[model samples]
Target: MPDSQTLGNRTRGMGEIVDIAGKTTEIAPFGNTLAELGRERPEIVGLTADMGRYSDILPFRDAHPDRFFNVGMAEQNLVLIAAGLSKVGKIAYCTTYSVFVTRRAYDFIAIACAHSMANVKIFAGMPGLLNGYGATHQATEDLNMMRGIADLTIIDPCDATELKQVVRAVADIPGTVYVRNLRGKVPVELPADYKFELGKAKVLREGNGEIGMISTGYMSARGLDAARIVQSEGHDVGLLHVGTIKPFDKKGVIEFARRHKRLIIAENHKTTGGLASLVIEALYEAGVYMPVVKIGLADSFFECGSQEYLEKKYEVDLPRFVRAIREGV
Candidate 1:
């Protein structure tokens, strides 16, 4: 296991994965995608809360210097300015640490953006246990908090392929959209031709109705790997990647759940009020009940450490996922 300093130097605050040993990685996919999109859409503008380097918005700032804005360290001002710009016809793409945006700028996002249906796309970096700064910096509950805002489109992309698609997808999506941004050397887990659609879930792998796994964010990548591992052991498993959290694919989830005997819900957030809770809510309301093993953080403030350490300590690592599927709990 690498130390925090070693992992931080390699991942640059992004989550560390033990399984992606030789997978292709993309550097600054968000910034490159925004810069490319800004060429065709002059109305698209990038803003960061003094997080250009870490948030990976510098490429946009370099490509369109005239359209980029850095609102210092004030997260509240970041959302407010993005919202203000959206009202005046420009599509605002803002970046910041997820913890600051969700915790400090909740009111601005809820009222100034979502409440008015502003075209402000918030790409929040260091979501969940990705950051080594721990609770103060990890936006583990961001989905739960942001999902409460009506009309807000919340998405937790799976990898570099999906993250790039999300940046372009949210540009045309009316109203405020919140994304759990993945920065640094993000793995290219999904297929290159994968198309991202809002409020839809993708079935990554099919099984024989024995076990099903629903996951969002980077956890989707882990779930895919775990599913394959469990399949090799003769236990059929299916993997559903739910990138969009709010406006969730209830029909897809219910349909997928109905095919499987048991379910495993995984996320990089607390088990409460996040992906696990959403899956259960949808299943119960649809009358598709089954035994579920949740893979996520506990209902407690996590301590600062490397991503590998924290994930293992909280029992959300790949091994835990594999065990959950193989053991049926």
Candidate 2:
């Protein structure tokens, strides 16, 4: 019998996976990410907690009607059902709002799923402040919540391309996966042929003078934009895009930052348990010194608004990041 600690050991590191050129993809529903997974594998099943449509699980629900289940408003039941299905040798993709899944359904995932090492991928919608619904709906601390848990794979994709590759890769990895996917059309950041592999960081552009931006999620694009803005203004700032969170590529970051003395960690997550925190810890452990700045969510829950509104208000927008870089200079 396989140990519970490694029940989902079919795949290990994301860096081990072959580079997938998901760059040809366009901005659309996360359904495409799931649909691509569905078309490729028959063992894959999808579950949702009354948010199949909102979380973009509708495509899987429609494509695999027999394999998909909607547990309806019950986050606990959602994880329970997915776990049962997974124990029976099914690869389950479960979707729900981040708040409900993280806060309301924490135990079920922590025990019923992770404790057993089930092959379940928890696709969380409205991660962080992407959802402007209300306080009760905000999932500002979901990453921090999942990061502390053991035997769970955590992913926060930067854009559509990374989203597709990450969805597929985590689906293949064993054990419970907590993925935070924001709704709507994510801008295309990577080039049309860019490659995505988990835990493998990419340097979109590097600092020519002395500054760097290591960004996660859609904010990575803002980092690139900020890099360009700073470049035009006589500052050479490099852009490092992190497609996968949690088990990050520390070696890559340390190597890059060792070349630059100034660094900025940009992300859509709050200051705690986000990109900023990880970079700081990794650098400290490696004895890498650099002035680090975080351009991401403020230490507060988001109010109602669109993604643009939330980004600008939280100082993660491109303009704000560029301005912050100027201030740093």
Candidate 3:
């Protein structure tokens, strides 16, 4: 483990509670979230490639059975079917594994969805090491793949708070969207009222003189833990919870980066085209110079392991995260 002195100057705090609307309700995974979306938008239809129950689209299927469609297990068929539905002006939220949805249905997704700029929201399950189902199931580089598709909207939500709100926001909205979803035990990390302004990053913890760590998805939660440990050693640590990956919030990130010179970017993925790439692009465009440390899985194929094991190996775990902050700069 690295020492605190080696961790460089700190910036962010532990985290913030966003005071979500309604009494803090523990919502079900895919079911209630979809059902709520259906209630909010009449044209919002649910589709899954034989994962209605597994992906949590059962409630929507049960409630609005007329609109919901299950195109069996073929991912290609799933995309074309959803695209066909979108032609009739329906907002279709397709559910499938990240690999099956992005890789298996690549051509169909490109031509049927992106070519026409259809409104198909892909609710992808098991991003990165969320599942130990091996590389066949893990979508560690889905962002790098999908963002390459033209006119496609990429939103990798950090928690259920933004997930629920984004579901409503993309309902019937134009263009194709790929959203990474957390299935079970998605701790209410972000506050309920956490805003979902498109292309915006939230300052979960404000740093005084320490490094600012910007993160997305489950790793942001882990980053919070890392921040706590570093602060105990009397370092100022800050966190930037970024929800939108594509069409990223450049100004907001530049503003956050301007506050601190030493920066750390943490994600549950390779330091490739995910958060790290986005931050570097933003800083380059802004012509702002700063020392940035990339704390994430490196650009290599990760072997199969338990979720905890993979997290530790990837250094996105709390203890490793603290060490990365200590060593990154």
Candidate 4:
């Protein structure tokens, strides 16, 4: 484990929430990937709500300053401008803090972008508990809020590899897309050859009908870690990484659930209206029920703290995951 000073220093300003111990990482994957894509696609435009640095969109802005627009801290205006750009035949890629986008500018997103199926791609930074700036910044319920918007495609990539893939994928996907963006030294947990498909869940590990784990966001990487730990103790554990939130892979989830006797649903957001809730709802609709453990935030606002402290205090750390796999929560 990293010391408090190390954790504090790493999470000082617009830093990552997850510990990157002994892992390969990419710096500014989102911005760099978008910049690379922007060079090829002239119709793609970038916008930010005064969060270009924090959201890691500066690379895109640097590459295409003529097309990059900074709407100065107004999330609503940001969405409206993006939607308007989309209406003008431009694929507008807008960014801001997840909490601000979902909480403050939700009406604009719902009405202007989603309602019209605009070609606006929203890259929301600091999703779930990924920020150290407390409840005001942590978008613990952004998934819940965005998933309800009709015609909105929500995605939560697990690592830098998938995040880059998603940045490219959404460009061709014609409609409103909401992505939980991971920035600043993002870990490369997925394989280099991994392909990210929209509306599909990828199975990372296979189990022997004993225990299966379903996870989204960075929790998918942690789920793989926990599955390995449980496997060492003679329990067969499987892992399914669900990158796409809305337009969820219900068939894949049902098939995975049918294979395992017990299941564990893990996510970075709240357990009530996030990934866990979606999985449970899918299982219930499919008439597949079993013992299930949910690993996520409680239905309460969190206080400002280091990612290590907050994850441990809220029981979403790696050890907590190992415990949940060993002894059902």
Q: What TM-score would every model get versus the actual structure?
A: 0.95, 0.88, 0.88, 0.97
Query: On residues 252-271, what C-alpha lDDT tens digit does candidate 3 reach at each position?
Result: 88889988868888876778
Model 2: per-residue lDDT, tens digit, 146-201?
87778877888776777777788887777998887745445466776778776778
lDDT of 1 at 49: 95
- lDDT by residue (49-141, candidate 1, tens digit) is 998888999999999999999999999999999999999999999998899999999999999999999999999998889997777888888
Against the true structure, candidate 3 has what lDDT?
Answer: 0.76
Candidate 4 local lDDT, 63-82, one digit each (tens): 99999999999999999999
Least well predicted 10-residue stretch by lDDT in candidate 2: 11-20
- The whole-model C-alpha lDDT of candidate 2 against the native structure comes to 0.75
Q: What's the lDDT for all of these models? A: 0.88, 0.75, 0.76, 0.90
Query: Which portions of model 1 show Cα errors greater than 4 Å?
Result: 1-19
Candidate that scores best on lDDT: 4
The list of candidate 3 runs beyond 4 A from truth reads: 1-27
